[model samples]
Target chain A: MTSRKLGGHFLSVMTVVIAIVVFFPIFWMVLTSFKTEADAFIYPPLVVFQPTLENYNIALAQSGYFRQLVNTLAITGFSTAVALLLGVPAAYTLAFHPTKRSNFTLMWIMSTRMLPPVGVIVPLYIIFQNLDLFDTHFGMILLYTAMNLPLVIWMMHSFLSDIPYEILEASQIDGVTLIQEFRYIIVPLALPGLMATILLCFIFTWNEFFLAFNLTITKAAPLSVFIASFKTSEGLFWAKMSAAATITALPVVIAGWVSQNSLVRGLTAGAVK
Target chain B: MSTLQNSVPTTGTARPPDKSYLRQKLARPAIIYLIVLTQIPVVFTLIYSFSNWNLLRPDRTRFVAFQNFVDFFTNPDMPVIIRNTLVFSLSIVLFSLIFGMMLALLLNRQFRGRGLARTLLITPFLIMPTVSAVMWKNMLFNPAFGLISSFLVSIGGPRIDWINTYPMFSIVVIVTWEWTPFMMLILLAGLQSLSQEYIEAAQIDGAGPIEIFLYIIVPHLRRYIEIGVLLEVLFVLNIFGEIFVTTTGGPAIDTTTLTFDIYKEAFLRWNIGRSSAYGVFAVILANIVTIVFLRITRSGTQQNKEAA
Candidate 1:
């Protein structure tokens, strides 16, 4: 019993140590965001310093940081909403009324995701330019929606599949309209799954780097592009860069924390079975 | 596409089921839109791969049989690029799997503050990839006045130029830091779902911890491990921003993966033909990995069905 107690204590301490190591970089970024430029680059990495909002002020004032924040919010919000709008019904059909064709379509949609963005970016860039959609918010929304559609469908399909068929059949026997059935019965039963899917989609859209990096120059550039700009000018400003990064990462970090449980389920949907 | 049509044959002899129209109505728009969005670009990429189209010399564009592909294959850098890609991706996957399993095992045991530990551990995976890259490149890996340098100097050790001295290793470290938590979460979910009865029975049978882990837990978690590996490979193959920010695939192309190489060819060199060919190759490589992964998991399911 004593040996078992000692082993339990050892495991707990190790868990604490691992947690600190995993979190230190992000904590350091947040700490640096509050330090001045001199303090940020100081040798031995200042443990004691006067915290200042000057870096945040400069980053917000000079880098168009607020505009980029708004852009990030708008892009992530609209793309996730649009993906859900298109994906939920399609997933419902696949879950409830699956045929051989439906199964093929689901697999095909997922296979589309396997095509690397690099392969498709060339034609997308050309098409966006010719259509006068380059660097526009609508253009980004469309692209992000397309990018996340497969994931949304896959996740929603898995979630909806868990709903018992008898529930839907009873509703059908009661002569409910299809829309009424979906609005009344399906939505209530699958609400938690839908919420999880939305959160996952939003997180993905928010963090996407390549498409936003390649497609947008200024008008629709999100925080990903904004932070990349600091890379070229990185040597000159450490504190400001840290501040921008903190502002960019904090919201998604919070969202991710809230949805961590659902993430595993969503990611391992078909494969885990 | 043909398979889809065949599955829904349109013979006039028998009317389709009543629910078929409803199914089509709910599902067809999303399907058609995805096909259009995906197919047009793929077809265009296919066409461009065979042409001699340089953005700078548009008028010189012509169908150049297989020259672009031949050039891509023969380029001296091709071997290094391919090697770097495999090494970077595989190393990240391997290291993360190891660390993730360790962390998952630790978290699976009954412990105080387990919930908080899990949340803290997941923070790295949540940070944006670009932000993570920049933090590592500028704050952590910077040779002068960086965190590591500060620590080493204070300890009277040497200051290493991480990106220049060991570009591939540095990239693997940064990516592993970001992805380990992802693996841990998936593996933890798998661990939590394991049946306690078998484990208890093994314990009653006097099996040691190592024996139980090897004989029971490992086999049970195989599917989750495969899912983690296959998903990581899919995302890690397109690791552009991390390399782009830190090394820019240089100190002489030491870290350029296939996607980064394609980006350079198309954007920097403005050689659409060669880049498109590279893109096609990347697609083929990703498809091969995906098909293998699908077959493994499909067979696992088949075995499960047969067992039942």
Candidate 2:
């Protein structure tokens, strides 16, 4: 019994230590963001220093930073809303009244996700150029909506399945229309799942780099593109880069943390369960 | 788009008597939207793969009938890029899985601040890949004053230029740091779900910790491990932003994967035909993985049903 207690304690301490080690990089980045250029370049890499908001000032002052941030918010927000609007109905039908083609439709939708963004970028680029959707919010919103639709459907399908069909059937006897049934019954019951799905969609759309980098140049460019600029030619701008990175990463990080438990189920599509 | 606008009110107002029609009405918009956005572009890619259309010399455009594919397969850089993609992705998956399993085991026990530890551990994965790369490149790997370099100097070791000297290793480190959390989360779920009774029974039978882990834990966690690995394979195979920021496909194509290769062929070279051919290869690879992934997840759920 004593040995077992010791082992448990050992494991707990080790876990906390490992967590700190794992989290150190992000901590370092946030810490570095507050230091001056000279302090950031200090030989010993100061663990303690006078903190400043100057780096944040510099980072925010960079051209198009706020515009890029606003763009990111718009793209992530609209795409997630539109995806939920489209996906909820589809998942509802598939869950409550699965047709003969329901399984096939779900499989095909998921398989579309398997198609890497790179495989279709060449044609997408050409099409976007021709259709005048290349750098527009409309174009990105369309793509991100498509991007997140599969996830929303799959997750919401599982969530909706847990809702007993008897509720809807009973409501139907009382002359409840489909929209009313949805508005009154489904949304409230599935609110937690819906929130999780929305957060998942938000994180993915926000952090997406490949499509956003390829598709947008200026008008619809998000913070991902803006952060990539730190990679070249700013010549050792560590503090500024950290500040920019902190800004870009802040929203998604919080979202991911808040939704961590649902994340596993959503990501694996209920495989673990 | 018109279909979307038309279908909404029809579903809301019409009140169809037929249930099947209502089902179709509810589902059609999403399916059509997906088909238009995803399927149509792929068909265009298929069409473009056969032609020789460089943006620089558009007047010379012509359908060359697999010539671009032939050129891609026969290119000397093909082997190098393919090798890099496989090695880079596989190694990261392997390392992260190992580390993730260890961490998962550690965290599986009842502990103080367990929730806090788990929250902090997943932070790297939450950060955008571009920002992760930039942060690592400038703050952690910069030879002049990077934290790692400063640490090395403090230890009386030479300050090495990580990306320049060890490009592939540097990328692998950055990506593995980002992905280990994903593996840990899935495996930890699997661990938590394991029945405590079985472990207690094993312990009563005089089994050591390692023995119980190897026998009881490993067999039970197989599905979770497989799901984690295959999913990680699918995601890591397409790693682009990290590589783009740090190495730019490196000192002479040392770190270029097929995805990056496609980006270069399409954007830099302006060779639409050739890039589409490369894109076809990427599609083929992802499809292969997707097939295997589907089979594994299907079997996993089936097993869960059987166990239940």
Candidate 3:
């Protein structure tokens, strides 16, 4: 009993050390955002300093943070939602049906993921401009959807694969249509995985800077481009930059915390063998 | 022929009214979306690559066949950019894999607080690339007041200019920080899945741990390593956030990789034609690499699984 108790105690103490390293950078960023501009760069830095909201005020008001927040939300939400609408059916097809083409299709989608987005970024950039989708949410949404669709399909397929074939067969025997089985039985079983996938896709979309930075000059710039507001012809505004960075990363951190368990499981879900 | 109506079973139970919509519910939405949304980008990108069109030139954009490709290959900066990109991506992949495997192996040893250590290691993976690059550049690696310099002085080491002095090395270090955990997570999974019976048997047969590792473990890890490397290489190829934030392809083109090159030509100079050429070239090169890797992996993956 003592040995078992000691093991538990050891793990708990280990958790404290982990909490330090894992939480430290974020802790420092948040802490630094509150420090005055002068205290921010001071050597042998003060752990404690007079907190101020002035940095956040500058970032939000003068930095155009609010519009960028909207752009990020729109693109992230729309793309994640749209990717699901396309990928769910594709996943359903692969799960219920079998053909030589099934494997090929899966491979094709995965192959797309393998290519660096840079490969197509310029073509997409020109395409966006020619089609008048430049600096537009719809344009960004479509591109981001494509960006994430393969992973989405892969996630859905892996999650769907875990459900026993018998459950679906039994549902069919009980008079459920293929679509019905997917709608009711399959979806409920895959809910946790679906949520995890959506959350992850959204985070990637939200965090993405290159596409958002290049594609949208002003109209559809996300938090990434918005964060660049602190950047200008002049040097970076450190306090204001930290404040913007802190604010932009807040959503992802909160979502990550909410789905920490599922995030881990979902990430490893696609690991074959 | 099948119906949701028939799916409710024959237990003398009443079927729901909505059971008849099965056949109507097809993947039309998905198919339409793929054709309309995805096909456009794919088709447009292909088309633009063939034309000598710059976005800024409204009326003078003209069709040019293979000129983009020719120009890309012959461009003054082409070789340098290609070399830098290859070096950056290859170095990141190599180090991340080697260090990741070693770390995974070490951390796999039953130790106190491994779980917490793991979470800390993976935290960088979840952090946005832009934020991570910025954080490292300013707070950790800045030559003037960064933690690296601060630590160096504390240890009687000299300060090094991470950006201008060693731009590529700086990028590699930060990327490794962010991606090594991804590799470790994968290798750890593969390691955990490797059964102990074989090792025990090998030990009984007079094999040492090192021999068992080389003979048994190395062969088994080949596929996982391939997969891990492939993923890392692919991500490194598209790395835009770090270059954008840290150095912006500076110090006289030292950090100018393919993606940054495309960005500079297209957005920075508004030269859509050349960038599209770069984009197409990117597609071809990426395809070649992936095809080769897959061929290599198809065999190794089977062996990898057998060991698992």
Candidate 4:
């Protein structure tokens, strides 16, 4: 009993030690963000600081944090909504109505995701320019939606697989039309998956850098671009950069904290239950 | 995409709501907009890929017949781009899977603070690629003001230019930082699904830790490991952001991967035809890789059938 308890305690202590090492960089960055410019670079690096909001003030005031956040929210929300709209039905078809081309189509869509966005970024840029969508929220939304559709469909298909067809057929027999069945029977049953899909797509677009960096200038940049504000020809502004990084990362952190309950199940979806 | 995967509610309530409007309307306002708006960009890209279009002289652009494909294949930069892409992506996939599984094995053990450890492991992944690159470049690896350089100085050593000296190494580090969490999550799921009886039984037989790990964990983890590795390979082969921020194919064209080269050619140089040819090649290569992956791993359909 003593040996077993000792082993358990040793493992627990070891886990905490590993956690601190893994988490050190992010914590240090957050701490550094609170310091003054001089404090950030000081050799023994200041562990305790005056805890000024000055860096954050500089970040928000100069970077237009709110405006950029709105752009990110709108684009991420719109793209996820678009992806879900295309994906859920397509997943339904592939799931319940399996046909000869169904598997191939699913694989093709998945393969489409493998097409390096950069392989197509330039072409898409030119397309957007021609269409007068350069630097617009709408352009980012469309690109992100199409870019994400494949994964969305694949995940939804996986989620839909768990729902036996008999349930759907029962709903159909009870006069539930295809859309009705989808909304009532399918969506409700697959709510966990739908939420997961929406969240994943939203987070993806939320943090996407290349499209935002290359496509938008100042008009509609997200917080991802907001993080790049400290970048300059001379060099980076360390304190300000850390501040920007912290700001950009905070929302996702909070979201993750709140969503942990669902995240576990959602993340492990289609894996062994 | 974790957010989307994360959104599926496990709650069994909120059923039997009126399906009236959902059925009567069958409306997908968002999907229609999604399709219509998306068609413009995709169609325009397809059109431009075929045309001899140059943004510089838009009016003079004309249809070119296979000229781009010939030029792309014959281009001096093509080989380097292909090599760079294969190296960058393949290295990340190999290293991430190896390291991810190790981390998964460690965390899967019964231990306190495991949840916190998992969250910490996941933080790197949640960061934006651009931010991650910039953070590493200036905060961690910058010779003049970076942490590594500062640490080196304290140890009586000269600082080195990581980006200039080893651009691919720099990219690998950033890419690994971001992707290891992804593989960790997948492998963790696989590890959890495994029952503990086999391992306990092995232990009772006096099998050593290393033997049990090799004989028990590795084989049982074969499918999950394959899934993790395949997904990592599929995702990594498309890496772009760190290259964009940290290297930009720099010091020479040393870091110009296939996707990056394609981006530069088509977007920066406005060589649409050449880029598209490369794009088509990329599609072919990707298809081959995924087909091999699905077969080797017995992914999707077979898994579903077994699952059912």
Q: Which candidate leads the pack in TM-score?
A: 2
- Please give, for residues B1-308, the per-residue lDDT of candidate 4 as tens digits: 78754654443344445543343222244334434544344444555567676666678788887777777778887788778877888888888888787778778877657878878777787777777777877777777777777888889998987777888998898898788877777777778877899989998999988999899888877776776676667667666667777877776889988777777777678766667766666656666777766565446447757999
Per residue, candidate 1 scores C-alpha lDDT tens digits across B82-154 of 9998899999999999999999999998878999999999888889999999999888888876688779878
Clashing pairs in 2: none
lDDT per residue as tens, model 2, B1-308 = 78645554333445457754685568789999999999898888889999999999999999899999999979999999999999899999999999999989888877789999999998888999999998888778878777888899899999999999999999999999999999999999999989999999998999998999899999999989988998899899888999999999979999999999999999999999999999988888888888887888877667768999
Residue runs of model 1 more than 4 Å from their true location after superposition: B1-20, B299-308
Q: What does candidate 4 score on TM? A: 0.85
| Candidate 4: tens digits of C-alpha lDDT, residues A26-125 | 7878888898888888776678668888988987786477689788888888888877887777777777777687666666665556555655566667
The superposed Cα distance between candidate 4 and the true structure at residue B248, in angstroms, equals: 1.5
Query: How does chain A of every candidate compare to the true chain A by TM-score?
Result: 0.94, 0.97, 0.85, 0.87
For model 2, residues A1-273, the per-residue Cα lDDT tens digits are: 999798788778878998998899899889989999778777666898999999999878866998899999999999999999999999998899887888778878788877889989998999999999999999999999999999999899989999999998888777666776787799999999999999999999999999999999989999999898889743377778888889899999999999999998888766654
Deviation from native of the Cα of residue A198 in model 1, angstroms: 0.8
TM-score of chain B only, all predictions? Answer: 0.89, 0.93, 0.86, 0.82
Ranking by lDDT: 2, 1, 3, 4
Task: Please say which candidate is ahead in DockQ: 1 or 4.
Answer: 1
lDDT-superior candidate, 2 or 4:
2
Clashing pairs in 1: none
Q: Candidates ranked by DockQ, best first?
A: 2, 1, 4, 3
- Deviation (Å) of B228 in candidate 3: 0.7
Off by over 4 Å in 4: A1-12, A97-100, A164-188, A229-236, A256-273, B1-52, B57-67, B293-308
Highest-scoring model, lDDT:
2
Clashing pairs in 3: A174-B7, A174-B8, A175-B6, A175-B7, A176-B7
